[model samples]
Target chain A: MNKIFETPLYPYRRAPEQDEERIMRHKVVVVGAGPIGLAAAIDLARNDIPVLVIDDNDKVSFGSRAICFAKRPLEILDRLGAGDAMVEKGVEWELGRVFFGEREVYRFNLLPEAGHKRPAFINLQQYYFEEFLVRRLRELEAEGRPVEIRGRNKLAAIGAHEDHVTLEIDTPEGPYNLETEWLIAADGAGSPTRRMMGLDFVGKVFEDNFLIADVIMQADFPTERWFWFDPPFNRGQSALLHKQPDNVWRIDFQLGWDIDREHELKPENIDRRLRAMLGEDIRYELEWSSIYTFQCRRMETFRKGRVIFAGDSAHQVSPFGARGANSGLQDTDNLVWKLRLVIEGNAPESLLDSYDFERILAADENILNSTRSTDFITPKSEISRILRDAVLDLSAEHEFARPLVNSGRLSVPAVYDGSPLNTADALDGPAISRPGAPCPDAPLGEGFLLERLGDRFILLTIDADAPDEIEEDGITVTRLALSVRDDTTGALKRRYLGDEPSAVYLIRPDQHVAARRPSWNENLFRAAIRRATGKE
Target chain B: MTDLILTPNLDNADDFYATLLAAHEGLTKKESDALHARLILILANHIGDNKLLEQAIEAARKAG
Candidate 1:
C-alpha cells in the first residue's frame, strides 16, 4: 500500500497568527518541506534559532522520486539526529554490475575499505527520507525547540526589504502576511520563490526522457545495481535496476529523445516492457511510474541579499548519478552553520559569500560529471553513439576498457579546494585530509572520531600539547586530545598524522578542515580562528 | 606543445593495412564505421596519453 503518500502527515491547522492582524516575524523562514527544506529547518531549530517551514502539500512526496542517499549526506543527517533511523530502514549496497548485451562486463565496489561508520551508499525511498526528517523535527519540537511546519501554507508572494524578506502566505483559512529576518528557499527545481525574484539559471537541457517505475515483487534478484546497455529487451537503449527496502525495485528505462510519453506510460505498454525484462512468468505490482527530463544548470550565485536558495532551487542536475538530492542535502549542510552564526551576530554577513564559492564549485563538479554520464548514456549524435558502442564492445574482454564505461560516476562529497575560509596548510599531511577537506571518520575507542567532533569548532591535537579551550570574538574553540593508541587499526595515524609524529588541526563547525600544522602555536591558532570565522 | 607524429610508427605497413581492411569485409557501411570507431578507441587507449591523442585528432581533422 502507498500509505505514505495518501496520508496527510502534516495536515493544515489554524494558527493563532492567522487570526492576528500584525505580521509575525521569525528568525528564519524556509519555503518547501522537502528533504532539503526540512534539513535546513531542523539544523537551525536545533541550534536554538527559531525557524518556520511552509509547504503546499501536507504529506511526504507523492512518489519515491530520489532513491539513492550517499554517505556524506548520511553523516550530515546523523549530525541532525536522523542518521541511524535512515540507515536502519535503508538498503546498503556497494556492489554494482554493468552489463553489455546479456553479459556482465564491468563490476565495481564503491567502497573497498573498512573502518568507516556508514556504507558508501544506501537505497531508500524519498518518502521514507522525508518522513525521517519530519520525525526528527518532531523530536526536536518535543524537546521544546522553536520550530514549526505549517501544511497547506503556500508562499504566494515574496519581497526582499532592506534587512528582511516579506512573504504573503496562502493558508487553509486565508492569506496571511509574514516576515522573516532571513529567508531560505529550499523549493524544488521549479522554484516559485526564484521566479518571484526574477531570477533564472543558465544551463543545458537534455532532450532525453527517462521512465522510472517502482515495482513490488518477490523476485530473487540480488541486492545490487545492474545496468544494461543495448540489451535485447530494450534494444538500442539503456536500463537500470536497483533494489530498495521491502521488496520494492526501482527500474529506470531510457526512452530516447522523441517518443509519445502517453503511449509509453500506458499500463499495457509498461506491463509488456516489464514482462520482457523479468521473463514472461513473473508477476508483480506497479507501485509508481514517472517520466522525467533533466537539465544540468545552476544560478550564478546562491545568495542574493537577505534571501538564500538551497537544494534544487539553487542547482539542478540529471538524476543518472543521483546528484540531485545528494547535493541538495550537502547545500543545507554547508548553509545552516553560517546562517546560525550570522543570526547570532557571531560572524559578519560577508561570511555567507564563502557558501556561494564552495557550493557553486560543488554544483559545477556535479554538473560536469552528470553531463558526461548523460552524453555517454544517450549519445545524441551518430558519431557519439559509435564511440559509446565501441567502449561497450571492448569492455567485454579488456580490463582497461572497464574504466571507460560510464553507467554513472555516482555521487561523492565535493572537497572545497582553495576556499577563502581555509587557512594555509602548515603540515604536509595526507592529501585526503588536507585543508578544506571533510574530516575522514576514524574509529575511536567505542565510537567514531566524527561523533566526538560533533558540530563545533575544535582544536584536535594528536600526541601534541594544547590548551583546553580558546575563545575568539564570540566563538569558542575547544580542544580534543587524542593519542595513536586510541585507534588500534592505525586509521587515525594514517588518515590524519601520516608520517608526522605529532599534529594539530583546526576543524570548522561544518567538520571541514580549516587549518592544520605539525604542532599547536598560540599565535597561529588565534589568527586561524580569526580567519576561519571571517573576522580577518 | 608537440605536433602529431607524422612519420610511420608501425613496422608492417602492408600486412597491417590488409588486416584492417579484411576486418571490415562483409560488413555494411555502418558496421565499417563501427569497426573504425572501435579500432581508433583501442589504439588511442593503448597510447593512453591524452595530449598525444588530442594532437592526433587535430591532425585527422585538419587532413579532412
Candidate 2:
C-alpha cells in the first residue's frame, strides 16, 4: 500500500518553573492548536498582539478531517496571509450534482457569476490546513510577531475573573500556571474547558451514524460534489463523494444507527463495500476511516466574563453542510479584531459582546440549515421519505422543485442582518452591499478591493472624491476612490453602486459593512465608526 | 393559474392512460382510492408551489 500523508510531530520542550512565576501576563491564551485555535493565534499575532496556543497533541491532525473549505473562510485566511497557499494546494470546485436512485435529478453551480477572488469551495485535508497555518505563524514570528505554540500541553483547569483568567496547564516537564488578560477556547467538540466551566450544550443530537473513509486512488472522477440518495450500491442509504488533494477521495456512507461499529470497520466488510461502489477494475488503498454521529448544539453564551469560546467549543453542527470548521474560522475572524482593540485599550470591553451576538446568529443559521439537510437526507418517518422522493422525482423535470431538493446546502458566509453595530440604512444604493454584509470583493487598480482594505477602518468612496486621512481615538480612516481607471470592467460599480452616482461606505476592520450613505459627512462616518467600535 | 388543461402533454397519452387504468385493474375500490390519494400527494409535493397546488385542490374539489 502507498504511504498515507501524516503531519510531522514537534518535540515537547520543557519550560522553567520561574517562567510561570513571572508577573508578566500574556494578552491572549488560546486552548487547542487545531485549525481554529491556530487561526485565532495567527489573526491576533498579525494585529501585533501576542498569543500563546496550547494543544494536547503534537501533530497537526490524525487524519483527513474537515475536508471542505468555503470561500468565506478562504477570504479570512487571505487576511491572515495563508489563503493563497490553501487555494493552490486544494481542489477548487463550484458545481455539484445530486442523484436519486439511478438518475441525476439536479445540478447546481455555486458561483454562476464572476469577478470573485476565490471559488465557492475547496477540498483539502485538515492536517494540511493546520500545517500551512503553523508555517504562516512561524513566518510571522520571524518577522518579530509573537505567536508561541506549545504542543503536548493540556489545560487542566480554568479560572475566570473580573480582570483576567488563570489557567493550570499540564506539560511534559511539570504542571504550571499561567495568566492571560483574555482566553479563547477553541478546544473542539469535547472541549475540556467547557466541561471545566460546568456548561452543557443545548440542542439536538441526531441518531444517524455516518462512516467517512479517505481512499488513496487514481480515479477519473470529476472534482465536483456528488451526492446520492438511495444509491444502488448502498441500498436505501445516502452517499457522498468528494475529491481532495494528493489523489485522495473522501467517501461518506450513511450507516443507520443499528450496526456494530467494529464489524463495519473490519477490513473485509470495508473492502466489500468499496468493491460494490467502485467496480472491481478500480484498485485503491484505504487511507483512513472513522464513524461519527454529530449533534447540533451550542453553549447558551459564547462569552462569559474575560473568557470567550470560538469554534466547536461554543457551537457544533452536523457535518452535512460543512459548517463545522467554516463557521469556526469566521468566529476567529470576528473575534481577533475586537479582542485586539479591547486589549490595546482602544475599544471598550462591551465591543466583545457583539462577537457573541453575531457568532450566535451564525451558529443558529448553520444549525438550522444542517438540521434541515439531515432531515431531508434521512427522513425519520415513512411519510417524510415519500415526500422527499416526490421532491427528488419532480426536480428532474420542473424548475420550481429544484430548490426543494436539499442535498446539504453548501456553506456560505452569514450576513449579520440585525447586528447592533450596523448603522441603519438611512441611505442605500444597493441592497447587496448593505450594512452588516461582508464587503464584496472587486477589481481595484491592479489589485483587489479586499487587498486595499487593511486592518483598519476604511472609507470607500465610489465615483466620488476621496477624503483626506482622519485619525482619532486610536482609529485611523484610510480612504480610496473607485474610478474608471480603478475598475476597468465596472465590476466594482455594478457591485457597490447599483444606479447611484456616488456613495460612501464605512467598512470595519474585519471587512463587514458598518454603514453606507449616498453622500459622505464626517460626523455621520465618525458616528458609524463609534457605533462599530462599541463607544456609542 | 386557476385554469386546468387536460391536453396531450405526454408523448404517448393513450399508452399512459392504458397503463394508468391497468394499474388499478386488480385492486378493490378502497385500494384504488388509496392509490389515487398517494398519487395526488406525490404530484403535489413535486409541484411545490403552494399557490398553484391550492388552486389545483380547489379545482379538483369543484369537479368532484
Candidate 3:
C-alpha cells in the first residue's frame, strides 16, 4: 500500500452548490463505485473523458465480498494499468487439489500447457482492490480528466431522452439535479435502477444458504486450491479454504436449508461450526463471518433507452466459479470502447446496442455455467448426489472419470457465434473458426507473444504473398511473412488461406478476429473495414 | 420505409430478419438495397454476432 493512498485520494469539499444549478455535466455518469462501476468510470476518465462516479458508501467497504478473479479480468485490469499492482497485492494459485471425502483424488497444475501471458487466477479481497482502483482514478483526475467521486449519494430517479439523460440524485448535501449524455447503472443485484425501469430480472434463486467466515489461523498449510467435497465437520456441509495475501484464511461452509436462520449466524454458533469443521485441537480466532443466499439470473435487457446496466444490475450468477464479479468487469471492458466511439461521434447511438447484446450473451453464459458447477458440487437431489459422489470416487481409479471429475469448464472462455464482426468461414479450425472468441496467444517477435493487444484494430498477415496495407481508420496491419505450411502458425494459415493460400487475419478492438482471407481483394478488404467500424 | 421497427432481441436470428423486413416495408429496390447494406452493419454492431452479421450481409447482397 502506498503512503498517499492510505488516506482519501480525492478530497473534494464543496461549500454546498445550489440545488437547481448544474454542478457538473459529464459525458458519462456511472452510478456506484464498486469494481465494475469504477472500472468503467476510470476507463473513460483515463481516455480524457470527464466522468462523475457516484456511490452511496461514505468510503470504500473494508470487508472481503467478491474475492476470486480470473485471467480475463486480470487482463482487463492490465489494460487499465493495474496488472502489476494486482500482482503486487494479490496471491496467485497455480496448483489445485480436490478431495472426495477423506481422500485426495486429483492434483493438477492450472497453467500446465503454458502459453498465456497472464496467470490463471488471483485472489485479492474486494476491499483492497477498490482502494487500489480509487487511488488510480485519483491520479488520473490530477491529469485534467477528473473522475468526480461523489460518495454518500444515491440515485433517486433517472429519465433518458434522445440526446441526454436527466438524473435526480439524493445526496447528503440535498436533492441535486444533473444532466449527462449517458447514465450507467452499475449498482448491485436488487438494483433500484433496474426496478425503476420496470425490467424483469428472470432467473432461479437457489434454496441453499452459504456461510462465509474470515479467520486468523496458526495452522501449517500450503498455498493451493484446497476443497473437501464431503467433510467430516458437518453431516451435510462442504468447506473451502483460501490463502489470502495476509496470514488470514477465508473459509466458506455450506449450511443446509434446515438450519435455524437466526441462531446459526451468531458468533458462538459460527465458532462451534468452525471447531467442529476444523477440529477443536486446531487453535483459531474468528475475525468476521456472514451468511448469504445466492441466485442466478440475467436481466431482460442490458440497455433501456440511453441508460445501460453493468455488473449485478445486468446479471446475477452463482458464485461457485467466481464468475459474478469477473463477468461484470468484462462488461465494463466490452462497453468502454463502444461508449468511447459514441462519445467521440465516430459511431451512431446504434453502436451502444452492441454492449447490451455482447454483455447479455456473456452473462447468460456465466449464469448457466456457474449454476451447473454449483450443482456438481452440492447436488440438489439424492440421486444426483450419489452420481456425483460415484464419479468422484471413480476419478481415483478410472481414466474416463478423471476428466469427468475435473469440472473445470467454468473457467474456459465463452465463444460468440452470432457476431457479425467475425468473417472467418465455417471450415476454419477451433483456434480461429469461432466468432468473438479471444484470439490465442501467438508468438510475435523473438520472445514477444501477441497477447498485449490494447484498444486498437490489428491486422495479422501470415501469408507472404498478401499485400501490405493499413487503413486510415487507425488499423495496424502486421505481416508475419511466414509460409502457410508452418505448423507453429498453421491455425492462422488455414483460417485465412486454404492449401497454398495467403495468411491474413483482421483483429477487432477487443482482440476477436474481425476478418480473415487467404488473399486480400482491395474492395472486399475496404468493405470489411467499413462493416467493422459500423460505416455504411 | 417505416420510421421505427420493433424487433426481437438480436440474440435470436429469426427475429432480427423479421424486424429488418418490417422496417423496409413499401420501399424501392434501390432504397431497399442501400437500406439493407446499412441495416446489416447496424444489426451486426448490435448483436456482436459476427456470423449473423456475415449472414445478414451475404443475404442482403444476394437478395439485391
Candidate 4:
C-alpha cells in the first residue's frame, strides 16, 4: 500500500473575496519539490515560518541524479535533523582512484579534516535524498509550523507584486490561486518562473553528452571512485564508476563529438556496451540509464522583482567535480537565513540583493572550477593530452604531484566578496576574529564542537578578562576555553589574517568570518550586526 | 613528446600504486599544498581505521 500525504489542495485555493472561508496565505511559496526546494521549505518551516511547496511529479522516482554530497552540505543537513537518516543510508567514499588509461595514476583516502567531525563525501540517490527531506517536512508539519507539500500541483502562472506573489496553480481538481508573501523559484535549469520574469540565463554550453547507467555487479572492486580516460569500450569517451548506496554502481561514459544518441540508449545496445567495457568475464545486471548534456550557465541575476532563484534554477555546471547540486544547496543555506530576516520584518528589500550578489559569485566560482577540472580530465587537443599525461606520470613518483592527479581543489569552500554584507573590517588588519571566510571549526570539550554559530550574528570571545560582555540584543556571544585559541589562531593566520590580540572574532551565520576584534565594543558590534542582518 | 601508454587495470595493484606516486612527483609547490588537503581522506580509506586516519592527517599536516 502506498502512503500519500493528504492535504486540502482545492479548498486552500478559495477566492480572496470570500474572507470568512478563504485559506490563509502562506508566508513563502516554494515551487519544485526537489532536494533544494524541499530543503528550503524544511529550513524555513522549522523556524516557525509558514511554507507551501508544489511539484509537478506525483511521486519520487527511484533513479540516480546527483550522487555526491560534500562535507558542507552534510553539516547543513545535520542542523535540520536529517543528517542521521542520510548517514545511515548513504555510501561514504573515503578514497578515490585516478586512472591514466588502465594504470592507476593516483589513490588517496579522503581523510576527514583532523579537527572537523564528518566524512569527506557521501553518495546517495537524488530521489532518496528528496524523500528524506519530504519526511522531515512532514515532521515539521506535525509541529505548529506546517509545510504543505502539494504534489502533482503544476504551477501555471506567477504574478509577483511589491508585497506578495499571486500563483495560478493547475491541479487535478482545477485551477487554484495561491497568494504568498515570498516566491522561491527552484523549478530547475529550464525554469518557468525565471521565464515569466524574463531573466537572462547566460553562459557557455559545452558540446558533450555523458551516458550514465546504474548497474548491479558481482565484482571485488574496492570502495573507491574509478575513472578511466579513453577506455577501450568507446573511442574518445571517458569512463567513470561510482558506487551508490547498496550494491548498485553508477557508470558514466562520455560520448564523443558525433554519435547516435537515440540508438545508444536502447537497453540491448547499452547492455552490450557495458559488457564490452567490463569484459566478457564480468557478470552484471543493468538497473537504469540516461544521457545528460553538460552546461555551464548562471542567471544574469538570481533575483528579479519578488521572485528568487535557488538550486539549478540559479546555476548549472558540468558534473566532473560534483559541484552542481552541492553549490546550489549552499545557495539555499545563504538565502534562507536572509529571507527569515525579511519575513520577520527585521530587514528591508535591499537585504534581498545580497543573496543574489553573494550566491552568483559562488555559482561563478564553482562552475568555472568544475569546468576546468572537466577540461583537464578529458583534454581535446594534443598539447593538453601531453600536459595531462606528463602530470599523471610524475604524480606516480612524488607526493607533491599526487594531489593534482585527482584534482580535489574543486571542493574548497567559497568565500563571498564584493557584497554590501561584507565590510572592509572583516578582511583588514591584525585581528583575532573570524573574518571574510568560514571560521575554521573549533573543538569544545566532550566531543561537541560549535559546528553552527547560528544563522544570525555569533560573537566568540576568547578573553574572559573584560567581564565577558557582548550584550547586543540580536548577537549571540559564546565564551570558549583557552584551548579554542590553539585552533582559531592557527586558522586565522592560515587565512592571511594573522594573530588576534583582542581575542574575539564575530562570525556571520553564512559561516564567513565577519569581524575579528576583541571584546565587542557595544556600539560597533551593534552597528555591524545591523549592517550584516540588513537592519541598517 | 611521446605520451605514456598505461591501460586502466584494477588487477595490477602494484602498477596502480606506482602510477599514483609518479603523478605526485609532477605537482608544483602551491598545487601540491592544495592537493594535500584531499589526500588524507584517500590514505585513510586505504588503511580503514578512523584513529589511524586521524594519525595520518596529523602526520601529513605536521610534515607539511
lDDT of candidate 3 over A1-536, digit per residue (tens): 22222344334343244434545556788988888889998888877777888776645644577888777787778778776788788888777777777778887676643545566777877777888888788878777776778776678987778778887777656677778888889988877778877786876655567788877788866888777788776555567788777766788887866667778778888888788767788777676677767778888889887788999888887767888788888888878877777788666667777677777788888877777777777788765665667667656665455555534354545565565544544324445434477666544434323454566666565543555556645444544454544446444444444454454556666666667665556666666666666664
TM-score of chain A of 3: 0.89
- Interface RMSD for each of the candidates: 0.8, 4.9, 23.9, 8.3
- Model 1: number of clashes? 0
Misplaced by over 4 Å in model 1 are A109-111, A205-207, B1-27, B55-64
The CAPRI-style docking tier of model 2 reads: incorrect
Q: After superposing candidate 4, which stretches have Cα over 4 Å from the reference?
A: A1-24, A205-207, A397-400, A406-410, A425-434, A464-502, B1-64
Candidate 2 per-residue lDDT over residues A1-536, each given as its tens digit? 22223444454777553265674577899999899999999999988898988888778877788999988899899989999999999997778888999888889876645777877788999988988998998899899998888888889988888999988889877788888998999999999999999987887656577888889886677778889999887888899988999888999998987879998888888888888777777788898999877788999999989989999999988888899999999999999989988889889999999999999999999999998998999888866877778778767876667777887877888888989899987655677788999888886756788888866789888766657677657888889766655678788888888787788888898899999988888888888988999998
Residue A23's lDDT in candidate 3: 58
lDDT (10s digit) by residue, model 4, range A312-424: 88888888777877887788888887888777766777888888888888888877787777777767676566556666666666565565554434455577655667555
Best by lDDT: 1
Reported per model, the fraction of native interface contacts reproduced equals: 0.82, 0.00, 0.00, 0.00
Regions of candidate 3 where Cα sits further than 4 Å from its true position: A1-12, A15-24, A205-207, A257-259, A406-410, A424-433, A443-452, A463-469, A472-502, B1-64
Chain B TM-score against the true chain B, candidate 3: 0.41
Instruction: Compose the digit string of candidate 1's lDDT tens values, residues A1-536.
Output: 57887788889998778889888888899999999999999999999999999999899987788999988888999999999999999998778888877777778776646777887778999999999999999999999999999999999999999799999999878898999999999999999999999999976555478888999986687888899987777888899999999889999988887889999999899898888887898778899998987678999999999999999999998887889899999999889998888889999999999899999999999999988888888787999999998898888878777888888887988889999888899998899889889999988888899998989899999999999899888989999999997779899999999999989999998899999999989999888888887777
Assign candidate 4 its CAPRI class.
incorrect
